[model samples]
Target: MKLREALALAIGGDLAHLAEVARQLSSLGVRVEPGGDVVWGPTRLLGKGNNGVVVFCRSRHGDIYACKIRRGDAQRPHLLDEARYLQIANGVGVGPRLYAYTRDVLVMEYVEGTPVADWWRAAGAEERARFVADLLRQARALDLAGISHGELSRPGKHVLVARGGRAVILDFESARPGAQNVTQAANLLRALGLTPPLEALRRYAERRDDLAFNELLSSLLGQLKR
Candidate 1:
């Protein structure tokens, strides 16, 4: 299915929105095979949510991107807010690089890797400990930026581990700003069975106190190193 056809299928009964979506995709020079089971524009379907279907796409220059298209009205009605949050996440290097986002579509750099749970399951003892530590750093970054990833507590589908062991957090549609950033730290402890409140981690990031942060991280890593 080309962009036009895909838009038609996604927007179903709404032909006007369909045309607009097609136009938006064309403006971005995106070509997709939505009819395919697992592929689109030299990329593949990474995941799909009530919000939209996330497909992998490639540019003429051979750059890979993740494209998310709204599902009709979308279960989450705040596409713009999600896009804004994505920009915030990008600012802190916490999520994928966002290319563009419209009322019904979003395009960003494709993060390649396994999910965090899968990665943790396959990692060696030392590697698992290191990965968790890196995850804490990312969470701290988000807290420092005043952005809270509301989904970290159940990050099974929102976190990805790149080939080089880089942890890439995803989906900022539910993020919020406020004090007491403990979701990331608490989530990691529950998911990884390691205990350490994230409050200290957030303070370490806000104060830019690297020595203390490293010391804390090292101490935690020691307990987890196995």
Candidate 2:
């Protein structure tokens, strides 16, 4: 089935779920216009994940926003978690600003940028290393703040290389509190097929020096074998 058709079916058939979402949106001061076939003009589908669907929409105020709509009743908690995480992540330079959210719908500042994986594929090794280092810095900040993005390892989850060299992390549905910074960094590296640069990251965390960071990363990569 077509993607739009599938979304319509899910929204229409699930009245209770829709009502809950509407209630949440209302509480957040977002106006939900009533109509049959509510279509935002020419919405581009970015991608879909196990937790929710993401679509780019031009808001009534002429601002572009990434609208993430969750799929089922079971997914509601994840949406709520994302809302909570965004509250902490606002202005952190790690993720998008949470503009609005309901039980099933989330509106966020749309980050126009290439995914880190794609950027890394086209980038030279030095640029990729820099990107990795910058990501680690952002992760450390979140860790210091006691926030854990539960799905940080997913490829496409971290949107980078935005306008003006800004990187923004997206998709926080599974994010929680109280996760180890080192473990999260390890998992992200493993997912990217890079040896977990634990030692380098540790050095950077300790002394905030790039050269020491690279040496530590080399040592950590060596340790990953055994």
> Clash pairs of candidate 2?
200-216, 200-217
Whole-model Cα lDDT per candidate?
A: 0.68, 0.62
TM-score of 2: 0.69
In each prediction, how many residue pairs overlap at the backbone (N, C-alpha, C within less than 3 A)? 0, 2
Which stretches in model 1 have alpha-carbon errors above 4 Å? 1-13, 33-44, 75-78, 179-182, 197-219
Task: Tell me the tens digit of each residue's lDDT in model 2 across 1-226.
Answer: 5544445444443666666655655565444322222343333355466666566555556566677767564535547777888778775667888877766778887677887667656765555566666666677667666787776676656555675445567777667786454456656666666776556656655664547545755554454344
TM-score of each: 0.78, 0.69
Query: Please, what are the lDDT tens digits per residue for candidate 1 over residues 49-109?
Result: 6667776566666666888777666666637888887898788777888898778778888
Candidate 2 ranges with C-alpha deviation above 4 Å: 1-6, 10-13, 19-44, 158-160, 190-194, 197-226
Q: Which candidate leads the pack in lDDT?
A: 1
Candidate 1: C-alpha lDDT: 0.68
